[model samples]
Structures are given as C-alpha cells and as structure tokens.
Target: MKKLTGVMAQALTIDEPVVLTGTAPHGILVCDGGSLDLRGGVDDRLTIEPGGYVLLSGSCQATVSIHEGGLLEVAGTLSGAVSRNDGELWAMSGSCIHGRTLSAAGFFIDLEADATPQEDAPRFRLTGTGHDLGIAD
Candidate 1:
C-alpha cells in the first residue's frame, strides 16, 4: 500500500499498476513525466496532467483537471460521480454498468450545478448503447 503525504512529486514513473488508497492531506500528486495507471476504487482528490488517463474501476470521487490535450478515460463502474472541471471525458458506448458522470468534456458548459440532486438517491448514469436516456440521433 503506497501512500503520498503532503508533498509535490514530479517526473514520477509507474512501471506497474499503482493503487492510491489513502488520502493526501493538502498535497498534490502531479505526474510531470510518467504514465500512471489509475486503478478502480480510487477515493481521493488529485490533479492529472495532459495526456494522462484516469481509469475508474470502482467507487471513486475526485476533482480532476484535464489540461488541454489530455485524455481521461472512465472505464468500469464509477460508483460515485466523476466531475471533469474541464477537458474531455471519454465513455464507452456500451460500457459503464451503474454510474454517471457529473459532466463530460467538450459537451457540457455548466459545471457549477450539473450534479444537483433532483431525486432522493444518487443518480447512476449507466446505459446500454445510449438507450437508457433516450438520447438518439
């Protein structure tokens, strides 16, 4: 179990799969020069760099900022809501089981109130081929 405390790491390299479980108190996990494989069940807040791919596998929540020319892929089930402050959020056409993103990249304009709770329970945005939401072309 690797843990990062209040520190600013740069040029980090992840040869194998890395799992960030604990919390970073007032710290920033920056990947200045390296490739990070974000596993599932990630429940933390961190800043991702350009060309960085954050793959969600389980229940996770984070305030991610995807810089210009960055790619954040949300794979598997996102138990919690994924809020992309900016940039592109790519989702599989036939993927995602029981979850929903607060906003997607290059499509959503409003971020302040995108995930406002309209129902009693947390809304899960999962569908099979864009049929659940009746969004078709």
Candidate 2:
C-alpha cells in the first residue's frame, strides 16, 4: 500500500464495503465521513468512521486509536503482535490494545482504556539488531 497523510480520503466517501489485501508499510487510513470495510492485512495505522469497521488478519502490528466522536468497530484475526511500554500505551486519549482482543490473542478488539495514561506516554526503546540503516531517510 502507498504511504498517505492526514485528510487523504477526507472528502472521498464510499457506501459499500472497502477491502484491502496484501501488506501496507507505514500507512495511515482514516475514514472521517464514510464507511470502510477492512480486510485482513498489515498496517501502521488504520481508522474507520462511526459506522465503519476493520476486519484484521495476518501479523499486522499497528497502533490503533478510535476517536471519541468516531468509532472503530473491529473483528477477525491479527496474526502479528503488538508490544509497547505501559506508560506510552496509556498516555494518549486513544486505545493502545496489546495482543489480539477479538476472541484470542489474534482476534480483533473493542478497546476500553483511559486516554490520559496513553497520551504523551514514554517511548519504547529498541536495542541493537546488528544491521544499520545505511542511509537515513
């Protein structure tokens, strides 16, 4: 999938179900005023409207947040994993779901956590991986 920014699909509205197949790297899909039907895939950030929903599948590890005014009704399975510090995960006024929340560890979720603890939370530090990014973006 292509990398996008805020208000990319703001005006673009769809009534039918929208599906996304394959992998998406560092992408953000926001539905401010439409219905979005998500497919099984990986994404960095995915947001659906009040009546929208996301059906996730595969090892798609991402930070999901459901707007107070909006809604993110999710279902299905997530093959990927999510890990973050307790501080950062509970700092924002959003949801930081750890592990699958649908039915099992891979199932989707309907987060119900405090936003205060998640906002401005501490960042997660990463150790060495042996390889370095040759050129910084």
Q: What lDDT does the true structure give each of the candidates?
A: 0.38, 0.34
What is the per-residue lDDT of model 2 for residues 1-137, given as tens digits with 9 covering 90 to 100?
Answer: 23222323223333345555444555435454444544434456544444444434233455454443443332333323222211111111222334313212222245543222222333222111111101111
TM-score of each: 0.43, 0.39
User: Over the full model, what C-alpha lDDT does candidate 2 score relative to the true structure?
Assistant: 0.34
Per-residue CA lDDT of model 1 for 71-97, tens digit only, reads 444444333333343444444332242
RMSD of 1: 10.8
**Residue 6 error for model 2, in Å?**
22
Worst 10 residues of 1 by lDDT: 128-137
Q: Model 2, clash count? A: 14
Cα deviation at 21, candidate 1, in Å, is 8.6
